[model samples]
Target: MTSASVPAAFPRAVLFDLLTALLDSWTSWNHAAGSEQAGRAWRAAYLRLTYGCGQYIAYEQLVRDAAAEVGLPESAVRSLEADWLNLTPWRGALDALRALEPHCKLAVVTNCSTRLGTQAARLFPIRWDAIVTAEEAGVYKPNARPYRLALEKLGVQANEAAFVAGSSYDMFGTAAVGLRTYWHNHVGLPLVAGAPPPEFEAPTLDSLLPWLGRFGLRPQTI
Candidate 1:
């Protein structure tokens, strides 16, 4: 089946996943660890601790735990954590957000702690309408609480907004909550078994603007 098309009407707002969709955490990890294997290991450890174990630890703690799990030195862990505070935006992410800003409200619904989320937001060039962190919900994603909390805070129904995520698991979680989901599948990963698929898929954030435009939701021209 083809990816779901955008609705004829525009959503009231767009909710974005912070880590991979907006920020290039993997790039920073690779840069710090000096190997792709090290970066992947740290991410795996992080996913295991957060999604697999259902823990809501601080983002820094996750970094520390992952580093220890992968046998990284303290200096490397410290540098990685520092890099998180100044995460570089994924290519086209900032431009996409800026283009969409005036058309609809934009917010970050992330699985990061409040402190980390706040720091990450400061790095963004655009101001978000709302920011909902898992720290406030007491749970990581795929649990429904974080997604529901974001809907509540945005004053929008699940169907009134679209949730953008970069991972298949996150696509499943957001879809379970009834939001129209978009997957930024930059790496060409397959959907997880038994997980709900996203309504739209694009190789990069920049590509979604045209898809939205087809549904009469084009970005406002300055």
Candidate 2:
């Protein structure tokens, strides 16, 4: 089927999960881990402390593991994040938001402590209509509460919002809760083995413009 034939409804508010969507985080994680030798004693600390013992785990688990490997606590990790340069700006994210901002409402829905969430927004360098953090809701992604909290703040229904995330499980969790999900695969990462694909998937944010058009907002002709 042609791409235009797909179901691509623009959301009243684009609920963005902060870490990987707007800011590049993987490079920062690697850089931090590399600063020390194989994370020294921290590697064992990470592998042991994080709850999920299986092969495949959630994205947050990675953060915890990295913290442990660095001989830091999760609370400390939450307070310290890689510098902005470690994170590359998402390709076309700035452009898409500039285009979409005129027509649709936008907000951030991140899974982090309140302090970290606000810090992410400051670093993102965009003006959001609103920003909702997990700390406010006392929940995290892959759990329905965070997304629900974002929509609630927007004063919109779950179906009226489109939740975008970089992880498969997070995408699935958002979809299962009721909102349409757009998976931001910026790194060209492979889709997770068992998780169902999201309503949107693309190598870069530029692709989101076309789908945004279907929702009564199209990219500026320039």
Candidate 3:
């Protein structure tokens, strides 16, 4: 099948949540700064389970189990969760993404091993057109399964769906699938040093709108 045609104004469905959208990099999770030590001594024991068991484990469950694993009671562990749980959207991101909510169907697609895309649904309000997580797709970003599932879930054509990915890999992924792609360009990752380029480049997530407008959008009829 050919790409779904772009509407005159904008895509009726737009997916937005990336790790860059929901959480900042340089945060401890990626750092693993003592995840092992923290997993053993910290309040959440379950945090280590994803490593030992399946990747789809819940952070909350990890938090709960980590507490028990580290010998802290669940109540005590709950007290320190605010400091331990640091995943949240970047600064100014909410307002920036907000500008588009009124204009189109906003969705979130994530490569997280868990339901991180949906978990983000609570922190930011986009009134999503759809939400898809890697666990459901059985593969990570750059893989066709997740992208395919996301398009199916969004009910939009490949061309109509502009994939906004923070990393080069995700950009390469969606573009390969024939969907328009936006490299959110947060960390200045090179474009795979000669890989096929993304359709658009955004210095920051805030900068993607004008570029996305090129694709056009339609009023969310539903």
Candidate ranking (TM-score, best to worst): 1, 2, 3
RMSD of 2: 6.5
Compared with the true structure, what per-residue lDDT tens digits does model 1 show for residues 14-123?
Answer: 88888878888878887788788887787777766777646577766777887888898778777777777768888988888887787778888887889888788778
lDDT of 2 by residue, 156-203 (tens): 887666777766667656766787777887767666566678877876
Instruction: Give the poorly placed runs of model 3, Cα more than 4 Å off.
Output: 1-8, 30-85, 217-222
TM agreement with the true structure for every prediction: 0.86, 0.73, 0.66
* Shift in Å, residue 29, candidate 2: 0.8
Off by over 4 Å in 1: 1-8, 214-222
Worst 10 residues of 3 by lDDT: 43-52
Better of 1 and 2 by lDDT: 1
Instruction: Give the candidate number with the greatest lDDT.
Output: 1
Candidate 2, residue 22: the lDDT equals 74
Model 3 has a clash total of: 15
Identify the candidate with maximal TM-score: 1
Q: lDDT tens string, model 3, 6-35? A: 433555556654666445633533234234
Weakest ten-residue segment in model 2 by summed lDDT = 47-56
